[model samples]
Target chain A: MAYWLQQILNALQLSSIYALIALGYTMVYGIINLINFAHGDVFMVGSFCCFMAAAFLGLSFLPALLLSMIGSAFLGVAIERLAYKPLRQAPRVSAIITALGVGIFIENFTLSLAPYPKVIPPLLKNITWALGGVTFSSLQLIIILLSIGLMFFLDYIVYRTPVGMAMRAISWDKTYVPLMGVPVDFIISITFALGAGLAGAAGTMYGLAYPVIDPYMGIMVGWKAFIAAVVGGIGNIRGAVIGSFILGTVEIMVVAFFPSTYRDFVAFTLLLLLIIIRPYGILGKPRTQKV
Target chain B: MNMHRDILLEVRDLQVSYGHIKAVKGVSFTVRRGEIVTLIGANGAGKSSILKAISGLIPYTGHILFNNQDLQKIPAHKIVDLGISQVPEGRGIFGNLTVQENLRLAAWQRGDKQEIATDYDRVYTTFPQLKERCHQLGETLSGGEQQMLAVGRALMSRAKLVLLDEPSMGLSPLLVREIFKVIAEINLNGATILLVEQNANMALRLASRAYVLETGSVIMSGGGKLLSDPRVRAAYLGA
Candidate 1:
């Protein structure tokens, strides 16, 4: 029982990171119907932001997190405006190719700057608590709580606020929203900013937990989170979190119960089976009428 | 020239193209304050395109003056702040959003926080059905209810001029009369109207004046008597 509990705790930490990153995919997909293949690299950039703030500027965890979020937000808005905006009216394949290209550019750009993978300096105290033979670290607790908190905050912004209303409105029908006094382009930019900011937060927490990050790291983690988002229902907010947890728990359990090398292989296979069963995903409704 | 009314919106030599196919070619018209002006025509006649231009939804080369201010280079959202609201064709309601959110969206650019509540109340009073389904998702509402919600949005936005595109489309005959009555009520409440409709008979009955558009140009325009004009009857009224 304690062993299961320990794995569950581990799953919570890992899933929270996936959840944060997954939201960026879901949100950008929600508004523009673009996968933003470069999103993984945005997560990569976010970690570098955190790395710079922590290692060079000597900022603590909170400041580093805030700075990383802001940096990623700006980077996200810039990416959307410069690269994605022109392709808004272009073919979907063009945008997808551009996104893949953008990801490659970001990876190469970072690779040229820093060829080696960097280790994150410990910004938080390493404290451990063992409850009934289940051991957990403070870093795990912080990552889990902070990530879930951020997701809820994102939920509030997407559902409760006026800007959030516009965001939802745009997803439903981009054409007529402006007639109701909505600045469609501006709302889209805000969506990108929010999505990227969350990814940045995920990157920062991810670095703190894993302690190592390279330019190429976003690819694998990003693909997994993208799968989580798809499994949860790509455009649905709550779905992404649920999918992330499922993916995280499954990945952790596979490593625990089976060969550690089969972690990703098993995870992908299970998600594939789930997708075949529920094509729209766990919470996603079939898109009967796409605007 | 001998009238007290001022033109609320003036379109001069407006042109809109959807890649070589000129949807609206050199269209010109004027909507004086407090008149229910209907633009009646068949599909592809540029009626909707004119509204799109005035609302800044599409790019155009001609001048559109709203309250003597040129609408050139203005964006769509800004056009709403200029006090013109369009209930677009297909009732452009965000189906996933709640009825309350749909109505609130109309008040997006308004600064009068106090008056906004009054507007909501007025809309609720006008369409009690909307109030009952305020918490429901917009897509769940019946067609008439959705039309009511769309028209109700005009009231919520505090628009001075309302551009209605094909409001009567896909509605039952009974609901059509009901919507037309509500539209008349909306106009009597003081918003100027530029109505575009394929249902010429219904639109003509409700409009104070009318323009006949054919192949992207105003072929003919006149007072209520145009409803019975021999040419209009043969071509449009289908008598």
Candidate 2:
């Protein structure tokens, strides 16, 4: 029972991180219909930024986290302007290829600069509490709480705010939104920035918990978060969160019970099965064609 | 309302070609202030192409001047800023946005908060059904309601001139009449309207001046009453 409880807590912590990054993917895909392959690299950049801010600037943990988020967001906007904006009117295939190129570029650039993996400083490594024989680190608690808070905040912005309404409008029909006098391109850029900022926050938190940072950290996490986005329903907020938790829990449980080496295969196989069974995803509405 | 002033919109020798096909060729027309003009034609007669060209959605070689300013160089969104709003074919409402949100988006460029609030209430008053479904997503609305939302959205832009492209398309006969009635009301409330329709009879009835487009050019241009001529009746009205 104690072992099970620990596994559950572990799954929840991992799931929370996945959910944070997945939100970024899902939100960008929702409005622009682009996969933003560089999104993962943006996450990796966030971890590096946090590390630099803490080590070089001697900033405390919280300020470093905030600086990391701002830095990643700026990088995201730059990526969009430099890589994605020029191809806004280009074919989807071209945009997808460009995004992939950006991902590769960022990873290689980071590898060239850092050249070696670095350990994340143990800022919140203190074990604060043990509930039901399951120890919880302060970082774990912060990660869980921060992820939930951000998700709720995103929900409110999407459902209650005017900008959220404009995003939904643009996603549904881009041409019509412009005719309505809403600057469609500006709204799209803002969406990218917001998603990037969230990914940055997630990256910072992930680094703190794991205590290891690498230039290529974003690739696997990005793939898993993308899978989570797909499983939840690519454009649905609640769907992404639900999908992340499911993916995280199942991954942890599989590794806990079975061979850890089979974890990737099992998770991917489940995603493939879900796709074949329900292509629109668990929460996505079926697109109807006009006759 | 100032008829003595310069022309509000002028299209001189407009020519639009799609690949090897000429959709609109040497089409010329003028819209004066506060006038309700209609362009009536058959399905392939290029009525929509002209509107699309004027709104800068399609590239065309033409001298399109609005208030003595050239419009061929501007993009579609900039054209809206120039005070020409198009309620395009099929009532292009943002299906996922709520009615109020749709209206708010239309008023995005306008910074007058009080005026926007007043306009919101005015739109609600103009279409009570829209007010009842203010918070409802556009897709959930019926076809008629969607059409109302489209027109209401256009009005929210506070445009000086509105280009309506087949507003009556796919609507029930009753809804079609209601839509035309709203168009007339909109004109009465002070916006210049340039309407295009396949239904020549309805177009002739609602408009003061009418242009008959056949194939890719205007075959005839006269007062709305003259649209009942024998040739127009046979070609466009299928008499």
Candidate 3:
């Protein structure tokens, strides 16, 4: 019972990070229908930014996290405007290729700056609590609570606010939205900024937990988050969060029961099975093809 | 001179193209204040393209003046701020949004909260059925309800000129009559209208002055009397 509770806690921690990154994927895909393959690299950049702000600039934990988020938001907007905006009218395949190319560029650009993986100096007081044979760390508590708060904030923005209404409206019929007096381009940029900012926050938390940062770290985490988004329903925000938790639980349980080597194999198999059964993912509704 | 001042919209030698296929070739026309002006034509006659260009949906060369302001200089979203709203082809309502949500979104550029609230009430008053289904998703609404929502959304913008494209398409005859009645009533309430329609009989009946487009050019322009022209009757009115 204790071991199961421990695994559940680990699953929640991992799922929070995945949920944050998955939101970036889902929001971009919802509006423009592009997968935004470069998103994982943006997460990596956020980690690196947080590391630098904390270690080199002598900033505290909260300030460094904010800086990382701001930096990532800028990078996200820049990537969209420079790489994706011009291809807005181009074929879908072209945009996909461009997103891949941008991802590669970001990965390499960060590598050139820091050739080796850097360890983040611990900023938070390392305090572990033991209660009835179950261990809890402050880092774990902070990450889970912060992630839940962010998700709720995002839900409020997407469902309750006017800008959120405009975003949802654009995803439905982009061409007609402008005629209703919405600045569609500006709204798209804002979406990217919001997604990247969340990814940045996740990066800071991930760095604090693991304490190691590298240029390519975002790649694997990014892909898993993408899977979560797809499983949840690529465009549904609530679905992304639910999918991430499911993925995290599966991964944690697989590692706990079997050889750690088989973890990815079992997780990917589950994703494939889900896809075969429900191609549009759990919460996704099939869309009619428009002429 | 009095007539010239009354011209609310004037298009001069406007042209639009898509990959070397000139969709609208030097089409010129005028919409006067307090009149329902229409551009009538068959399929592939560039009627929709003209409306799109006027609303800045597509790139075009030549001059379009709306309320004496050059439309060529304005972007599509800003065109709505200038009080020109287009219903667009096929009643472009957001399927995922609710009726009330759709109406509120159309007023995105307006700042007068009181006026906007009144407009919402006015839309519900004009189409009481819309009020009944205010919370229902747009796609679930029937064809006639969708058309009404589209027009009702246009009205929410508080536009001086509303551009409607094929408002009668896919609707039953009874519903079409109902929509036309609302259109005429909208005109009576002091909004100038520019209607684009393939249904010439209905288009001519609703419009005070009309322009006939053929092969991307305005082939003829006149008052409602054009409905009597044998060529128009035979070509458009099904002689």
Clashes of each: 0, 0, 0
C-alpha lDDT (0 to 100) for residue B118 of candidate 2: 93
Q: DockQ numbers for every candidate?
A: 0.78, 0.63, 0.78
Residues A1-291 of candidate 2 have per-residue lDDT tens digits of: 999989988999999989988988898888888898899889999898888887788777889888988998898888888988888789989999999999999999999999999877765546678877878778888889988988888888887777787888777767666676667777887788888888998999988887689989999999999999999999877899999999999899999999999999998898899989989889988877542
TM-score of chain A of each: 0.98, 0.96, 0.98
Each prediction's whole-model lDDT (CA)? 0.92, 0.87, 0.92
TM-score per candidate, chains pooled: 0.98, 0.94, 0.97
Q: Write the per-residue lDDT of candidate 2 for residues B107-199, one digit (tens) a residue.
A: 877889899899999888888999999999888999889889889988888899999999888889999999899999999989999999987
Which segments of model 1 are wrong by more than 4 Å?
B1-5
Pairs in clash, predicted candidate 1: none
DockQ for the candidate 1 complex?
0.78
Residue A262 in candidate 3 has what lDDT? 94
Residues A1-291 of candidate 3 have per-residue lDDT tens digits of 988899999999999999999999999999999999999999999898899998899898889989999999999999999999999989999999999999999999999999999998887887999877789899999999999999999999988777888999988879889999999999999999999999999999999999888988999999999999999999888999988999999999999999999988999899989988999999988999442
Q: Per-prediction fnat values?
A: 0.92, 0.71, 0.83
